[model samples]
Target: VLLGIKMSPEPLKKKHGRAAASGEKRSKRKPKRKETFSVYIYKVLKQVHPDLGISSKAMSIMNSFVSDMLERLAAEAARLAHYGGRATLSSREVQAAARLLLPGELARHAVSEGTKAVAKYTSSE
Candidate 1:
């Protein structure tokens, strides 16, 4: 699904190396930390439900649920991609993510809206 997003799956290290050899200075940006979708979902879920009983079993269940939710959110985001191209996720993406991440919970509505509102402000380039 991320194929058409034009994102490079591999780091452009060779390109950077060539540029450096040619006396071109790279921006020196920090490398991006690798994260699985499950990890991303876990963090969001943890933020939403800070005290989910505090047991290993409970944490395991939460992780499972978050992974499931991330799958759902990814599907929704893929659907919404029909309206946009390889752009950064927008309000729609957040809504989709929140809906899947916190279904039937009171925080869902607020988080969904908040994601959109925050995206609007932060997305200005």
Candidate 2:
């Protein structure tokens, strides 16, 4: 009887494996890199909607989503650069990739914003 129920007459077979040897060398895996964007996401959300509140769970989801989106965008931009036979990624390739990825007025607005940002950054240096 097992747990007050009837059991099979034959006992379960035990699985066998080599026991761990204390002196044996084991392979070590590299630590995974963790990307965090919670604080940045929260700050941006607050800036855009000052009166709105975001739950911690929602913020975490948004952070992951935004990080993934940015990574995809950068990867697409790099692909565009490669397609253009250039080893280095440039602003032009990024702009072209953004235009290809974004639609209509959004593309225009994004390009303009990017241009403004580049100009500001260059002027600061």
Candidate 3:
């Protein structure tokens, strides 16, 4: 049953085609190069703990975590923009997305930091 609707199961049929019956596995794509956000992460880490050192493995994990978070934020912001009948994502959408994704004080801090960064960047230009 799907969504409260009962469904009958159909017998599975064997697929016959060169694409399916070739018996040859598709070649795996080459792996992407490891992207390191090490420099930026290290800078922040240093700020938090002056003498702290991070391992390459830790850096890799941090990079993956940060990249994943940023991707989710962008996707959420895009969704917010689309929900509001807009084609382009703006700062407000991003801020709203952050609030939705982050918990309480974290969202406030993130928004404040982002605002300050944007202000500094705009003023510098």
Candidate 4:
């Protein structure tokens, strides 16, 4: 038995221009430059630790930390992707990057080991 269904096919409408097809108004506005990794990390830390006031010294240290981490991650990600014939990075690749950026050999090794533990846990689930 047929249910209560309207099975008539609707007519297609033709579009006039590219904007009409996409339904967005194209503008001459240029995209804004993204804030660096340092800027973003600073903003988040500031929010969480409000008493740690934003100062040149604080900003300088935090910015340097973030910049180093991001740069290392980028380089490691590129290397990993090259082996796979890809030119982009994954979250795991970013972890490798973070490990590379850590200040001391001990810290870097610790981070790498931690990352493996995390990956194992995530993959198991």
Specify the highest-lDDT model's number.
Answer: 3
What TM-score would you give candidate 2 relative to the actual structure?
0.67
The TM-score measured for candidate 4 stands at 0.42
Residue-pair clashes per candidate: 0, 0, 0, 1
**lDDT, candidate 4, at 52:** 71
Which segments of model 4 are wrong by more than 4 Å? 1-39, 99-125
Taking the tens digit of each residue's C-alpha lDDT, what string does model 3 give over 25-50? 65566999866788999999999999
For each candidate in turn, the TM-score is: 0.39, 0.67, 0.70, 0.42
Any runs in candidate 1 off by more than 4 Å, and if so which?
1-53, 83-88, 96-113, 116-125
Candidate 1 Cα lDDT to native: 0.64
Error of 3 at 108 (Å): 0.8
Query: lDDT, candidate 4, residue 103?
Result: 63
Model 1 clash number: 0
Model 2 Cα lDDT, one tens digit per residue, 34-121 = 7788878878878999898889889888988988877877999999988888999889988988898888999999999999999999
* Descending-TM-score candidate ranking: 3, 2, 4, 1
Residue 51 accuracy (lDDT) in model 2: 91
True-vs-predicted CA distance for residue 94, candidate 3, Å: 0.8
Superior candidate under lDDT, 3 versus 4: 3
Clashing pairs in model 3?
A: none
